[model samples]
Target: MRIRSVVDVKTSLGESPVWDVEQQRLYWVDSMDGRVFRAAADGTGLETWDVRRKIGSLALTANGDGAVVALDDGLYRFDFAADRVELLAAPEKDVPSNRLNDGKADSRGRFVVGSMDTLEASPSGRLYRLDPDGSLHVLDDGITCSNGPCWSPDESTFYFADTWTGDIWAYDYDIATGNATNRRVFATVDTADGGACDGMTVDADGFLWQAHVYGGKIHRYAPDGTLDRTLDMPVRKVTSVMFGGVDLDVLFVTSMARPPLPRFPEDGPQRGALFAVDGLGVHGLPAHRFGA
Candidate 1:
């Protein structure tokens, strides 16, 4: 696949690229910059929203009216029409060292997120599920930095990546209960190529596409942990990716250019730029909402 830099606005810590199919736009976050951004699929008409805090990830509401964001300190409902963000729940409010990192909605429309040690000072990161009813439940703990979280096309398997460990683990997911069990390593990454695993998305064929931070590449794997293909990216900090477009064939990828080890400029010219990959001949599953 040929990759092209679609968004020129470099991001400090670009992550969480989500495609809004109805609007024909792509949404993403600059985690370290405390910002959210979206643009047309063609990379025109860019728009940005400053949440005034670190935005780890965000998913749209069930009706596409708003977004439930995993901010540095809490979960919020952001409405662009009113330019307001209403606090929904704070899963780690008391833990000042921990910040929301990466998250996504489940097939059942519940928001599940993970947190990470802000300074890598401790393994205090954990994962939680935010129910549609606004209830919070702890799913896992003892993580230093949590990143990718996605599910299989069959909806029976769930995957989560620990950025520091370079391991992407899987669980037997219970869609009805919002529970993930039977944790096992689903895929592994070699950081020598770039960095640890960062973010991910599953295609309609149940293939997992993972962006490798500091790795300068994205890897595609089959369900059984075999590497299917790899896309060598120009940036070392390839933060996250998602498939979006009228047919969900457009692969939108986000990267960073900031203070992380193996920083940008040294990596490549498009280190902090968002990229669009075409002719992949694959489509992604639709994203779920927070409270549909």
Candidate 2:
């Protein structure tokens, strides 16, 4: 498969690339710019949704009416038709240093989100599960940059990433009780750059695909945590990946332009761009949003 640039988003911190199967559109957020974008399946007809603050991630509801967004300060229900947003609840209001980051809906439609320090400071982040009925559950704690709470196809396993630690951990997932057990290291990255795993997705074949921030590539792993394939990217900071297209053969990747110390040239071609790769035959399940 060959990687090609689909569009130049110019997002300072592009993250959470999700495919809306029903609408045949791709949705994503510019976390630092506080912008949400939607484009046709072919990367055309792009439209921007301006939000009040940085949006971490978004999920379509079970009924496909609208989306539930994890904003910088709290959770909100977004009415796409009305273009309005209503606050649900703030799980981390007391922790002023932290902000909502990666999140997605579970198999049962419950939204799970993680919080991390905006300034990349101490390891005070935590993962929370927000049920449809508004009950909140703390799943894990003491993380610096929480990312990628992706689940297996059967909902029997969960994969989470602590970006600061450069470790991806796996857990035995119980969908019925919403409990995670057997925490073990699934993958680990080098300490030189501390390049950690970011957003991830499970394919129809049960393999996990993860984007590596500062690692300059996306790694595909077998179910048993063995390396499958690696797709090299021009950008240094890849944030997320998702499978889209009618047959789910196309892989969509989102990247950020910034690096830690010396940044890339402003005119570089690969930074903040949406990319696509063909020939991958793994299909992804539709995302479920919070109900109204």
Candidate 3:
């Protein structure tokens, strides 16, 4: 019920927000700045790496030595010790105008990611799934700006958002085969109210909590896509959310400090800082690590 900024670091376009329960650390990305960050649950022991390319998302590897990241060009293996990346796959080599955007690992440990048209002028982006064995499969397409990829508690439903269209879609997910099908609209953000759905996480109770970028709020939706409630935020560009802390009860949120457009106004001083919501009386599922 109480929201407070937990980190002293601010980012240009903060996103992702992944929590590693085993290590008791939180990892996040500053997309526009192409930076990856790690810190303890209390915001101590902070470390950062400049990947030199726009990074869309990050997923922890089971071995804890490296991470799998969605860079502007493709999926790469990020080595924490060496601070370098090795290309894993570039599914969109032909689509030079598009870049990988939002992604997360399924409960089965396969990474699911979506690309976006950098210009936001065409549906040139596509969704991809990277299996642990190093095979990449295209699942969906016709996306302009991709964001918010997560799954339900039962692992039956996969959720993703196309920021340009303001629609969040749900898919019939096959945990065994790592397939996503039966795509349908799960929810839509009324941009007239001033933002698109950016990132999301499902609570332990199966409710979807989404960050409304530019609207400065988080929307909680029931399993059937009914709006359960909304929590206003102090910053306008709330980018993503995750659950962390000792018991995984705290809701960790990331935001953006950069202005939306070239000449647009900037947000408050706390815009790109990481914030934690405590006392929600709810917990969340642990983030799945890359199986390989």
Q: By lDDT, highest first, what's the ranking?
A: 3, 1, 2
Candidate 1 residues 103-218, lDDT tens each?
99997889989999988558899999999999999999999888889999888999998787878999999999999999999987877754678899999999999997777888
lDDT of 2: 0.82
lDDT of each: 0.87, 0.82, 0.89
- Give the higher-lDDT candidate: 1 or 2: 1
Error of 2 at 46 (Å): 0.8
For 206-230, candidate 2 gives per-residue lDDT tens digits of 8899998777788898898887888
Model 1: residues >4 Å from true position, as ranges?
261-266
The CA lDDT at 58 in model 2 is: 88
Q: What TM-score does model 1 achieve against the real structure? A: 0.96
> Best lDDT goes to which candidate?
3
> Mind giving the per-residue lDDT tens digits that candidate 3 earns over 1-292?
8999988577988999999887899999999899999999889899999999999999988775788999988899999999889999989888898889899998777999999998777999999999999999999998998888889999999999888687789999999999999999998777886677889999999999999988899889999998898998889889899989989899999998885467434688898999999988989889998874
Reference-based lDDT, residue 117, model 1? 91
Backbone collision tally, model 1: 4
Residue pairs that clash (backbone atoms under 3 angstroms), model 3: none
